[model samples]
Target chain A: MTGAEGKPAPGKEGAAVSGETETAATEVVAGAGAGAEADARVGVEAGAGAGGQAVAGAGAATGVRDRTAADTGAPDELWARLKAYEGRAATVACAGKDPVNAPMIRHWCEAMGDTNPAYEGPDAVAPPTMLQAWTMGGLSGHEGRTDAYDDLLTLLDEAGCTSVVATDCEQEYLRALRPGDEVVFDAVIESVSERKTTRLGTGYFVTTRMDVRVGADLAGTHRFRILKYAPAARRKPRPGRPRPVVNRDNTGFWEGVARHRLLIQRCTGCGTLRHPWLPGCNECGGLDWDTVEASGEGTVHSYVVMHHPPFPAFDPPYAVGLIELTEGVRMVSNVVGVPYDKVRIGLPVRLEFRRYEGAGTGEDPLVLPVFRATEGGA
Target chain B: MAVTADRPVTAAGAELPPLEIPITRTLIVSGAIASRDYQDVHHDAELARRKGSPDIFMNILTTNGLVGRYITDHFGPRAVLRRVAIRLGAPNYPGDTMVLRGTVEQVDGDTATVRVVGANAIGRHVTGTVTVTVPAGGA
Candidate 1:
């Protein structure tokens, strides 16, 4: 059962015992030096050997691992895993029929904080963003090929890709999901191309489409950009420097900064508060607002240290904050004065208006709320 | 096909007049993924046949997007999609055309109500209404 010399042995019970004995016998027959010397191709990286090298490694340990992990020798196991999702497979069919489904209208209503009976009411209906919620729910389980993008990834992985990462997702919603309605999904592979090499490895960029339906009616489509990685050597991080602040927009908030009191608005109808001074409340359809002063203290709901600069005005390793304010509203701002490694969830933060320069010339003072690490809580 | 403007639309009024726009591939695809829908009926011809459908069916998500897009296009780019209520009446198969038609039903200072109808090659595919906020002067 021992595979040939250079091949990797798969991790399976049936093959392990027999393969070990044969492997010992082969070592004796080929001789220690003869095995490596006889197989000159053995020195190049383990996986990418030539046909001759492959034959030599056929019974070897390396061969088995690769074969088993790939869809070669362990077809039954892979097939079993894939079949587990037969019921939950991604499709362009109506969603309502699948009663136990994720991202249904009920789930969306909860996520968007819509409490009105209108969505479920006999006469009233749901909002258009419901589609966005459904899509996010579908993509939550990013591992399977029940959808087009997942199918494409499965195919690429079968074709010998090492790793895959989702780069971007853009969705344009057409309508909202209504009660008693079934949603269908359509998917297609848009394009694939070899992208530039990165620190991780050389990779390819793949794009795919998923079209939705509700029983013969057109819904919306989602375009997904995915990155597939190839093997590469690792690199070290460069010397650290202070991350720069991103403060371009927010002139209006900064103008209010001169007033000395922090001001925010609440919808007159629904009592929902909003920051950045919106004309109306997204909830309750109310236009008039009541101003309130925030305690300027909030918790960091989620944040990331962006290593790559999306725009020229920003630099690497800058902390971007999504803070849930004391007023129960969430806003995206900079988490200033904190070290790169210190940002984490539930970290207490305070607000202070700071000036940020525009990309071109003059610096514009913007009111930015920066978060710092709390002293007591773990 | 070109059609005459149905009626004049005022920005700051109770409600802007309804508009009808044909469904395009872009909007169709957007709705599909926005809803995370992936089925043969929505995109695959052979699969649709296997599933007892005439052809690839239009997705509910895509319908929602189109209806919202149609209203927003008429209202102005700044209008956000607040809510839409519709019941599917008939199937909207590929190659069949559909229209997004709506009318201003009510107006309260900042919010206005619009009733809309989605008709296809058959007749009415979906009928419902939406409430959206327009800038004070459509500015």
Candidate 2:
């Protein structure tokens, strides 16, 4: 029976006690510390740790606390209190805002530039990476979130660890989430790491495990981790432009850039040309390929001026264009020598090699290919 | 459209035709909205700058969607996706381009597993493995 204080009655036994009761009982024992051994013994006897137990048996009895005590600023005590929150519910049976449906799927595919036919038509299922998307509360946020996670964060904030960054997340899909399947999930504070020093600062890593479900069957699990840290002095280093990703298939292209040459892949079998490089030609499925130096004369097939989210290496309000080369291949590059607003489709442009000074970060100077609008073409 | 009758014969070392996606502000914002993720960092540039990002970046779901697209685009319409597991690295900002490349790693009966990596100007945006079932038997 739920007692007046919401804690399970001390002597209750058997499967009748709900998960909420077990969680409440575990919290009480963890807060009361070693003095609650008798209660923990009873908890073990009553099948309390089955679904929602925070810490089992002797584990809960060791981290006793004086809830009314003032801050001691001791790292061990803070860590102990943080560890006590492990296995607590972050959100319980939270319902998705929208069920798996087609309209949203279409929108997602469109934005991602994806035209895979499997995502359309009648049998379409939500994208698997959409595991977390379905759980997001959107503008208003869901009401199913519990206070424990927030309380943990507040405790860290009070301890001078205020800044937060999401490090990474991993997901495993058990089944495809189809339209009309009502998504429901429960999240648990899986663990909290001890204080550690990182490049950003000293902080603790908190990871949460969420099990998403449809009806009573488990569908997938998502584990997310974030680092809560104290702020360090801001470094004034000017960040360099993001480096291009180069791998085996396209290393030749980058090598071309280093030599101030723009190279396009040409199929050895069919003579078809391709841009951005590929291992096999799409037209011939030929594995052997050779490179051809581009003439660099092209017209802007399309363009977009980026004004937001400024980067240190380049000025904003510049035009990035899809240049369709005379050789019949298109590639994306910055369009220069013209105002961002003046750049237009079908504008004639010529390629130029631009050298960028490194940010004194021990990186070599980078030479990249950009397109400049022809005189009077703008 | 008749199920193609014949599917491409898949092998372990087969490579998928690469896809190039121009990262644009429209793609970033629409991807966020479509996924129902209303986080400020995904849609609002000023707020994102205040929070330390240079601009709004692509959400993980969008990255996932692109990866899924890369696989199915190669395996054709009848391809059924079973699993997608990915980890994020570099953020995908507008004015950049992300090129997705995939290789068929294993094929067992109708199910084939592919390794996918999406790289942009900054670095590798996403790396993961996807398992899908493609229709059996073709050239």
Candidate 3:
């Protein structure tokens, strides 16, 4: 969360009573000149640390807290009343004649997982992928809020529903964010549905969409699925790492080998067989390599039945293993066709073709690699 | 509010010149949407408050977008992202305001590395490194 503090800090006493419901109708407008200015180059001492003190100063400026305490019957009505003014958008916008520069863009470059020089040098430009960060407005300025899915809880509570839990998250990326660009953001309530109610009071699934724009250009959109469930119901954990999605790039590799067949990569230079196609060959600096058929014979190199899914799309207590092909190539494959506990390391396994659901449908489906124990092999 | 710029090219132990970028709530939200992250913290303040977050936390994806733009804006349109590594430190809170600063640390061939930082109306919030490939000549 973006605050003076790295983590969620305690909210003011008044914020509790004011309640987000009351503040829901209020809209905050901010810009380059939103708040009291700070020395631009003070670094951390002034920005994150001084921000807390500035809030205190705002509280002291108007001795209204004392006045509100005497007039209102509420314990912290004055404090709550003060919260409206005390709270500001949690983000700090960057604006100037030279908004994008070495330092400015570098920070974002690091954030997006793109540190490629081809994108950030003076003559080089940023890739489209970097746009993901530029469009992000900032963190909610409110303190003590950090969970990614906590908003659903608050909305459910406001709706007289206390049982709410985040079920899953699915995300996709479009454009890349760069420095100096000004962005506009708005969260649109998409759809709220009461799925079903069981022993738990009510099972509701609320989905919200957010729209992003850059100077009137529709940048992208996001959808969130918030699931509200009863507190006592034992919620089944979501699948870990959804089955791997195979695209044109890796489809051939799976179909040929998984169907009791073998496919291998042969170097153009030496005509030696290679399992995986890398950028260059060890023998020759050539990037040339061809996909060829392989023999479906190999020994088990290493195996692991993961009880946990790394990507949240697959259930745990499953198995994954590395197999050494007769061609001296090693491949990572998911181990299946046997009980989880029955699978052992160094057991021989063979290629098996299995169907897996993908992000798309029909003409374009995701494919995965599956392996099974050889009849007499392991 | 006082607005001043010395036009200093570098700071103490800094590698490159300082840089700035105009930030916006729209930019943050759009970045989040583009990344397919619709967490209320980035969009709805009420939702953020209802949850435990003091406010919305800028998703790492959005931060990367803005930072990428910041560098490209300075380097021009031809630059490519070579390697970028960032450790998210402070959250860039909405309305907090930021002024990005950094120093060029190294220059090799068509690539250059920078140590960067983003500060708000209050102070510095993010710090990290960025390396980009420039044209044949240095920027």
Candidate 4:
């Protein structure tokens, strides 16, 4: 039955069918004017008369299409087609593969260094921030992802907007999730913004809204937006010129730069060696300190790749390692000579001095003690 | 009157009492770690500076939690926050205070929408719409 056009069969014949028909009709009404996309674009642009003009010219389709063809470029057709998919399901139908449980919650807490006791023990609830984690398809994706998302992605791909980056996400949690509660969610293509230019590229901001349900109750909504567009003209990575914060207590460490030595501050009173040049020994609160030449050896205690809010001085995804020196203190420094993802924890590294190009002024060159990965890695 | 979560008691344009929260270094870092966000810009000043930020900044999770707290505190024990959609603008930096302000945007049978904005010294730290299910009685 043409649900969109179906009339209610006199006197409630069937409740389910009528409900389905009405919903389908709503979708059809919402998805109206597929053939009048160009005119609608003009209407949106003109903010008034153009859409009325197009609506008036509905019978004069050929004439309007010719004028649109002669006026704007052809990309609007694809944009309009993409817009037609709005309000449609992004995922087919999905459920959390596993119910929310404590073990996963504990692991997430541990990874996040979260000491919040609310997420533990009996009567505990998952962190609201983990709303999306419970819905992830993991290394293997789930069954609910629809073709529209993939098709839209492919369209962007064919248009040379191959690289996709998550711009940002907004999540709303309406209910607390308890362990053993199953999650079900449905995603919709909410809106597609007009093509816009950004530092990254010229692309459309595609937003998908997901309504997460706990049983039949509405629990939350997650709206995620991403840009699907061609890469913009690239800018050169900023040449390193960042000034190291030099101040009391750490000035000696910079002075060691002049001597081509990496100095670790050793508390004279307690003999605790610190790489960061802390003022006092934590063990004894001893302010008296002297230099100990670093043996230039350490292991990667932890590391991260700086990805967002790109900087001029450095490109993103570069590894910054927290190296645990054999001398018993940790120093944060850039890890060079290895791929960023390859810079793993427990990776052995040796300290090396590298002088950055002189900052615009012929001031003393900014020399730094960077760690070079030693042989052997995970 | 103790406004329990079950009392549906609010009207459109009702303003929630403003909350002034301190943004500390520990708040930013611990919040980041709590949210499982290990981005260096959120904790390491040296790294943050190298990345162009003057100092470390707050993570989105902390902002989310703070926003959640703001609404729950107002609605009381029975209100269930059904949705919290927020977008960040200014960074919540340490040594600054973020003041949260909210206006109830809409009130239906048992639900209310609160528009919230958190502002720090520099400017708007975060802004978003929160939809919550109040107890019966049109809060």
Give Cα-based local distance difference scores for all models: 0.44, 0.65, 0.43, 0.60
Which candidate leads the pack in DockQ? Answer: 2
Tens-digit per-residue lDDT, B1-139, candidate 2: 1222325538999987788989899987898787665556667777656545567777656676778777766767667677776655566778989888888899898988888877777667767788888776553
Candidate 4: lDDT of A26?
7
Candidate 3: global Cα-lDDT? 0.43
- State the lDDT of candidate 2 residue by residue for A1-378, as single tens digits: 001111111331111111110121111110000111111110101111111111212211111111222223444667789877776666777788888888877777778666665566787777776777777776666666567766786777666566554433456678788888888877777667666543334445566667788887778777655545553334556777778899999999999999989999999999999988999999989999999999989999998989988888778988889999999999999998888899999999999999877777898777889999996555
Candidate 3 lDDT, A273-344, residue by residue in tens = 765556557777767777777555666688787865455556678767787877788888776767666667
iRMSD, all candidates: 25.1, 16.0, 14.0, 15.2
Tens digits of lDDT, candidate 1, A1-378: 011111111231011011000011100100000011111110101111101111111321110011111212322332234333222323233232332133454454332223334344454444554543343334233222234335544544553333432332334446545665565443344444423233223334444445555656555544443334333332223323233332533344444555645667777888888876777678887887777777788888999888864544566688788988887888787777677667778778887765544433333434344555554323
A253, model 2: CA deviation in Å?
A: 52
Q: Could you tell me the TM-score of chain A in candidate 4?
A: 0.44
Candidate 4 chain A worst ten-residue window by lDDT: A18-27
- All predictions: root-mean-square deviation over Cα? 26.4, 21.5, 22.9, 17.3
Two-chain complex of model 3, DockQ on C-alpha atoms against the true structure: 0.05
- Predicted structure 4: clash tally: 9
Best by lDDT: 2
Candidate scoring better on lDDT of 2 and 4: 2
Can you tell me which runs of candidate 1 are displaced by over 4 Å? A1-135, A139-378, B1-30, B137-139
Residue A204 CA error for candidate 1 (Å)?
46
